[model samples]
Target: MSAPDTNLEKQERRHKPSMIALRLVIAFAVLALVGFVALQMLGSGDPIAEELETGSAPSAAVD
Candidate 1:
């Protein structure tokens, strides 16, 4: 038996709705991660200065 040659028509590929939604979700997740990192970098203060201002040892108990 011989297989039929069904490659006569070249079909145009279209983006699936689920694929588009997945891409959008991935893009938003990346953006969110970048924003979180940016906020962390921008909001971080000097740890030594904070410790000095607090005037307490790191392991000291506070009453």
Candidate 2:
């Protein structure tokens, strides 16, 4: 009985580090995906140029 319990404990200990590493990889992947999406949203510079081309600049002098 004690031998079986020790074997089970050893198996669990062996697998723990691998489980932790897998969780870390998944977390990093999610963070990278979020950062990619954020960059896509924030790095868009073409719309401002389009607005400028359309002459949509606000006037400084108020009549």
Candidate 3:
């Protein structure tokens, strides 16, 4: 019984490192996805479209 328990514990220990690495990878992936979505939401727009709708171009000359 003790021998079997030790074997089980060793297997669990072997799996722990991989599990931690997998969790870290998943966390980074989620973080990257969130950042990408935020950037898209904040930056999504066509300046040309806005200018077309407003029917104006900003003057480059400064008084």
**Candidate that scores best on TM-score:** 3
Over the full model, what C-alpha lDDT does candidate 1 score relative to the true structure? 0.74
Of the two candidates 2 and 3, the one with more favorable TM-score, higher being better, is: 3
TM for every model, in the order presented, reads 0.49, 0.56, 0.62
How much RMSD separates candidate 3 from the native structure? 6.4
| Tens digit per residue, CA lDDT, model 1, 1-63 | 765654434221244666778999999999999999998888568676678878866665669
Give the per-residue lDDT of model 3 (tens digit) for 1-63: 455455877898899999999999999999999999999887558776667778998545568
The local lDDT score (0 to 100) that residue 8 gets in candidate 3 is: 75
Identify the leading candidate in terms of lDDT: 3
Write down the RMSD of all candidates, one decimal each. Answer: 5.8, 7.4, 6.4
lDDT for model 2 comes to 0.83
**Candidate 2's residue-wise lDDT over 1-63, tens digit each?**
455455877899899999999999999999999999999887656766667778897545568
Off by over 4 Å in 2: 1-7, 45-63
Better of 1 and 2 by lDDT: 2
